[model samples]
Target: MRSKYTSFTLSIALAWGVWGCAPSTGTPHPPAAVAPSVPTSAATPAASPVTSDTEAGREPPPAEGGPLPSAERAGGHEPPPSRFPEQRITLMAVGDIMVHDEQLEAARLPDGSNYDFAPFFNQVAPIFQEADWLIGNLETTLAGAELKYTGYPMFNSPDSLADTLKQLGFTALTTANNHSLDRREAGVLRTIEALDRAGIQHTGTFRDEASRNQPLLLTKDGFTLALIAYTYGTNGIPIPKGKPYLVNLIDPALIKADIARAREAGVDLVAVALHFGNEYQRQPSAAQREIAGLCIQYGADLVLGAHPHVVQPYEWKTVTLESGMSHNGLIAYSLGNFISAQRRDYKDVGVILKLTLHKGENGEASFEEAEWIPTYVHYYRKNGKRQYVIYPVSLTLAAVQQGQKDPALTKEVLNTLHRLEKEMKLHLDSLQKQEKAS
Candidate 1:
């Protein structure tokens, strides 16, 4: 998967950690020496350079067992003031980050081993740097060299992907996708250890009983946020004879129970990351809609989805809590592939959905507003020596809404995202129409 930046202040991180008492053990390492941006094949001369070395395949020093650096240690440039209002908690969520074979091969160092990914993330780090928190789906196993790494059918990515993720501003990552157990049981343990060492947090797959029972909690901007992750299946991989707890599955009864615990703990917000839906499908399935509705009813405030390997529509959903209280939530049905080798249509385009929650003067917290950034991942020159570099489309909706010099290419990307969005809209509309008729 590709890396991007997200920024926040160190003081804020310290304040949150002390106040919330959530262990901040695995924070990402600071960014490294300066570098130049690798201009994309399709990039205009005016496009900003992608400067971070992580994107360029440089590795950062290990961040394990040291006194954590100040919040500035969190890599990436701070977000603009306008992006985050005062006294609010903002979260940015992205889709699947699949580390295919090509990525690993490119990441290999001179020692004939995989290099760490933290450095490469420094390039696009600014995008996520500003949010109070960031989330993404890790669609590969961290099984290390003991197991071979491959793409498509099964994936065992470099363990260093966790370090890259932490540096890129991800507080929590979901591991409950179809490829969750690509290397079997060993991959699960190694992945968790890698994340733990980097001080990054994770949910979904677990190596043991303790990891399985742990609920990832992050306190940001005076709000306590809880994250829970689950997937529909494990690419048909058996969950080790009697180990149903190895990975979380989307079970309604279990989800309701989990939400109940979060609410009882008085978490300010509850976010559910679901690895569901069909591969490359533009819209959510009936099962996805039903499960999302169930999450809302059970007290989840935001729902992020994945496993489509392509972009899906986003919706602003509101539901009444069991206490007869109304609340707003964002259901990003699917975020598509953040960075991958996939050349399929909307599969190359994804959305970074940002949500903010604020505590009003009256001591009440409410959902504020939401924004979506449309991104495209244009593969670098696949023909020859420059095959390793992949340029994630950085243009905004405003930029793409206008026609491009290459109308055909622009049309292809936008049309794919738009069609997916339309599919999501149609599903919602059908539900609304049925309600009216009833």
Candidate 2:
């Protein structure tokens, strides 16, 4: 019989195609440095640089100190000094935030007027707070109690979920997914409203056509980012007639246009969040790869994917556009479930993907580094009350190895933690090696 650790290694090797064998020895690396400062609650709209293709051909404004020296002319004007101060911003993204029936029941209060999800994220809150921007995929609707809160095929979670996320330092959320319209048009609108009230920025779904037309632009530490989100489909629910802008649907043409708009707006970075691929699968499907490549070619600097419910591999690619301009982009196929009731092999495993964007003194922005922290959802019962908690797999493994006793650390949970720590170390090490080779 195959050991669980062997099975775990094989599963990751199959999905990633990079890990040749498990590490022979060595303690797992510690987590990366936490973010330094808290980001603003909301990003202001940046001034547009170019309005249309006609204006796109115009030259950019001269530098503060003037033009650079001419190589042909001897003793021409000297190069100008760098004006903008160097800045770095950290962004963290996680996968599906699903609310199942059991989760809702656990959060229910005695009077039933409200739900408290604050406890669910207690362990992970500090990690998230370290990031300049923490983003996630909200896989359920917050359509209020009028819709009779439920879960599963059609999920309508309490608005308190959004509130709890905001309180825990969630900078933004991706609102496009199969369950975007679970409660129909009303649900879609209500979800946006709830997020707005909680002061959390979101994209992929809109309350009006005008809002949909605008890109979700965020500014932090002198860097501006344009975030766009799209889903493959809405679980076969027909979008209301004459309201095609309710939810963003995956289309190359539409995606290209949005990327162009972001460029015209002069945003420093363009990040695309996609809800695609087969559920429970650990590998990126053909469609997922093709679409991700297309987005990079269209001018996206990074692509964050979800909806697989299972963690997948990530890679960095350099894409050359039709105009002969080449750009480097990062593609993370899937992130799995951040927190949920699922107990399947990889279903409970997730990652907090972190990337640092550095803006040079000359106003040029690029990705400086990338890393991920593996996480696991721990479910346990205490005092006759069920609880769902998230734990960083590496830390949990360290604790277990030390023979510490804790109510939440059961034998099965410890096994899962060990498997996760090994798999994550191997996966991340492989990625680092590939990056160095490239």
* Model 1 agreement with the true structure over 1-438: per-residue lDDT tens digits: 112221111111111111111223422111121112222212222221224436534443337976433433676443333432336667888889887666665566658756654433432466676678988999888788768767777988766777778777888888888887888888888888888887878898887767666677888766788899999888788889888778999899988888777766777778899988887877678888888878877778679999887776654455555555554455778877777767755666666766555553333354444445545554443334223322234333334546444322455555654554444334323433454466
**Against the hidden reference, what TM-scores do the models get?**
0.70, 0.80
RMSD of 2: 12.1
lDDT of each: 0.64, 0.76
lDDT tens readout by residue for model 2, 380-424: 887777789988776566656788777788788788877777776
Candidate with top TM-score is 2
TM-score of 1: 0.70
TM-score of 2: 0.80
